[model samples]
Target: MKRIAVVGASLAGVRAAQELRAQGYDGGIVLIGSEAHLPYDRPPLSKAFLAGTVSAASLELLDAGDLASLALDFRLGVRATAVEPAARRVLLSDGGSVHADGVVIATGGRARTVPGWSGVHTLRTVDDALALRAALVPGVRVVVIGAGFIGAEVASTCRSLGLDVTVLEALDAPMAPVLGPALAAVCARLHLDHGTDLRCGVSVTAVGPAGVHLADGSLVPADVVVAGIGMTPATEWLAGSGLTVSVGVCVDTGLVTSLPNVVAVGDVARYGGRRHEHWTNASEQAPVAVANLLAGRTSRTYSPSGYVWSDQYSGRLQLAGHPSPADTFSVVDGELSSSSFAAVWQRNGETVGVFALNNAKLFNRLRRPLRRPAVV
Candidate 1:
């Protein structure tokens, strides 16, 4: 029987397998994951799970029964050493090789850790978040490095737990590069309103075992320090695998790799015409590769429109289409003081994206038209 080896066992890989079976490819599907735990929801890891509102068991993306019913051969805690595309196989770290008619590299990305602050922790995986959660006890002073999405969410979760939290962002604003200054400032304020001491434009030149040491030479003491620096895709083991492994394993519009019978997806994939690290994009991109692999249906293509959102305070910030710095801008609504309504971002007279704050109705109304953009 033909075999499909999905490396990375993350959202992209897991979704790929589920879609493959749904599309009727029941051969032999093996899921390779470095983490010992079964795939679970990463987004919630910083939210409800960390807040103690949701149990770790409930954070599971798939239960044992679901995996058993799918009948997938899960290779958890095993890493793929190399992918021999010509040979249509993947060599594992354990010296075992899995022959594959097609391979999906969805290894995802790892959270980038900061130097010093050796005592600091990050939240990327279940284990990472679990350890971080333990340090977020009530009344404990938690110093968080980096105010990115993960950091912001961690800060939000900590605040919800009635813990004293302080966030340090090296950038001028939280999500500075992504949301631009205008909206990013509002995000920073939201954190501050929620009892989080957000320090923007602050660089952590060196973190100490005691806490985070700032560029200004002030020592921020805390019971524990959680770093949300960032993440790098898991592609070290894929080096020289005859695949374009730059920042991410580059894939084409169809999510196909340079080598035949091999493809990549998720955070590890730089797919479409450009790289999209968003999870929804990963989920949408995986099926295209899966369809080509099992059913011999290879006509599908993928266009990357990066869309990512965040739940900060009482708002839901959603972005559809890619809006660049030079892109045109217009606000449909900006009633953020009440934390409701939406903001429309335009580029070249086209609606490139819409960011909403507790405005799902407006978000939905803007999505279809935005997704179906036409050159006028």
Candidate 2:
């Protein structure tokens, strides 16, 4: 390929570009991004950055020298309208087009927002964090909708700043689908222990100036509201692009879309019937996708690492492997009520998942077995 266009300057896209260069592909790379700023780390946006503990510059994924080495035709602040796989061209919103031999669709998802609610804020970008940070002040009653990782992190940051925080979850338990009821209860306790008024199994009807309106006619008064429900995959631009997009841009194990020349990665890619929005998943899929894209077919299959970590309250939460409610959970070290512990989920007799809180060493040791690939 003479040139490759990588859509979305996200972690996955940046990694894809780097992988191409590393693999001795000395071709033209057009890194397209909708954001004006260079690709930056997004994990800190809801925590340290929102809490004013980290600067914007510290979040950059690449330095000036590193970026210069990649030899990228950086197209920042422009949205990709559509892709023509057969013609090998990407249509841009600026009335321009990027014609390349290959295309990488890494357009990650955007944070879900509440419509018709001007007062509600959703944290996804640097601008979103900055806007929310400015609104957060002393004694502001902050009500966070959704008790997922992002919502919990936002509430934890707010509480750290000495703000009154209350988190609402539509489900019976936060992260129940992944953590299951047993471990999910531990997550719920973590919020309560940190002095957060966490309410589960609640339905939110509307968001007005007064506060959040519930279906049962109860109002949760708040001076500031943040919606951390989830993210919607940014696949609107690929509507007529001939790629199978179901919730996300559907791809096979090789991260190759329906078109041989096109591939996807990160939160926007639904690989092997599952889409992981984790940082590790995004970074790991790039190499495989780049390989398959260059090979023009499925040469290597992508396997999920199933690793995710979060910082909230006093401990660092970590999980590895695919854990479901059906799996049996047993604590290996320390107690669940304690500040530090490591646990594993078992299916029949085989261990399927591992979880830890402030116990990195043990967790890392236990994670190795799960990382081993199965013999076909």
TM-score of each: 0.93, 0.98
For all predictions, the C-alpha RMSD in Å is: 2.6, 1.4
The per-model lDDT (C-alpha) reads 0.78, 0.92
Query: Candidate 1 lDDT, tens digit per residue, 151-237?
Result: 888888887777888999888898868778878877888898888998988888766667777888898888888888878878888
Error of 2 at 153 (Å): 0.1
Clashing pairs in 2: none
Model 2 spans with C-alpha error above 4 angstroms: 373-376
**Positional deviation of residue 363's Cα in model 1 after best superposition, in angstroms:** 0.8
Model 2, residue 216: distance off in Å is 1.3
Tens-place lDDT digits, model 2, residues 1-376: 9999999998999999999998889999999999999999999999999999999999999998888899999999999999987788999999999998999999999999877866899998999999999999998999999999999999999999999999999999998888888778989999999899999999999999999999999999999999998999999999888899999999988899988889999999997787899999999888889988999998888888899999998979999998777778899999988889999999989888999999999999999888854111
State which candidate has the highest lDDT.
Answer: 2
